[model samples]
Target: MGDVVEMTSELGFKYSILASGSTGNSFYLETPEKKILVDAGLSGKKITSLLAEIDRDPSDLDAILVTHEHKDHIHGVGVLARKYGMDIYANEKTWQIMDSKNMLGKVDNSQKHIFSRGKLLTFGDIDIESFGVSHDAINPQFYRFMKDGKSFVMLTDTGYVSDRMAGLIENADGYLIESNHDIEILRAGSYPWSTKQRILSDQGHLCNEDGADAMIRTIGNKTKKIYLGHLSKENNIKELAYMTMENQLARADFGVGTDFKIFVTSPDTATPLTDI
Candidate 1:
């Protein structure tokens, strides 16, 4: 990812990816009032440093929103929330599994927030709408948030996106989506047969081709930015992921920078602040 951020003169919601990929995943979203983190798959120290880069303090966040109980998504959720005494939000099933596994040990009961899948929840001025995603987890969901007349969709970790889910998120101004792997590379790679089979299954992750195809199908007039995340380190590279999607869109008669900006988030570094 680069430092070029799509910015406007007016004050609005700002977003940045702290880290994204198989090792860990986390991102920051801020309105003028609320500071929210999508996931804390990384360590507490790493997340804090990333926040420091953006001149934000860990204590400033209003809430930490978890997508699922996978370690890559919630590894640091406990430590961060405990350190800041912050509110943590997840669906009841996710919370139960995490608690049962002792993944997030001893969180404040009052600070634990829950929401129902396929329902809308409000946090101050932000409206959070979650829909079930076909991931191999205990009722995983993809989040759609609306605030100040603008909307964003966070869709990732799912094996495939259903048409109904596509329609639900088509109107988003910003979409943070997964471009996990390359089909050919994955099939020919050195991983074991069973692991590869599971990955290629519907309950696994999305491949680059499928993700791009879905994006093109669901893209709307309101769409402004497309973030490509959750890349595979061994099976895929950044250039391959970017070009595969870019070329597909180009073939569909959509200019890259002109139609909508595409930001390729890295697994290690934080992208520049982008205002939406």
Candidate 2:
């Protein structure tokens, strides 16, 4: 996940995981005519460096879309939007929380934009659709982007993906879903009981098993690429998460490399530019 590459010339759709995990999370997406970041959880400097590794400049980004108001997701949103003069889009509830808590410091009024849930947001050539998720934050949501008859879905920071959500994201060309933790490991870990309970709750993060089930419910013939994102640093191991998903999918007769490829995103590095 460390190698950097130049943007592809033939790209109708491409994306890279700038970083993932509890420490920080961000995604970089490119269309033929637009560049956008899904989240900016790291410092502005760190995010800029990650972009530079992939031959991207922060200023080149057209928009910054927020999934929630959590610090890990909005840490760099304000800084990047202010420095680059980029639009910041989020649902009204999320925007209200951020503004009330001053989570994003002083973004210009013009740069602030609101989007409705379950509605389509057109950003350049990409048609973006957002859906609510079971998260602790007020009105947390995930997104699916469609372009050129292909779709790419990015889902994380959710406790579970409901049947309705599965239907909405089904049959996409690519998916980046959360595989946050291992249940056994989390129970055995040193986290306080309350914290553990919160994580295991319906409004907390998804465990490996649940994440696998969510994927199994969705994913149609059009699906080819999958990314395991937002893994826990202490409660889960990378290899364990990968094996859990692989074995679970295998039970359903879906071969990993044959049905689709899975890539694990890193908390500190950028994955290679991947085409959707």
**Candidate 1 lDDT by residue in tens digits, 137-204:** 99798788887778888888989988988988886888888899998999999999998888788989
Question: How does candidate 1 fare on TM-score?
Answer: 0.94
Each candidate's number of clashing pairs is 0, 0
| Model 1: how far residue 38 lies from native, Å | 1.0
Worst 10 residues of 2 by lDDT: 5-14
As a whole number from 0 to 100, the lDDT of residue 145 in candidate 1 is 80
lDDT of 2: 0.91
Candidate 1 segments exceeding 4 Å error: 1-11
Question: Top model by lDDT, which number?
Answer: 2
Q: Give residue 59's error in model 1 in angstroms.
A: 1.1
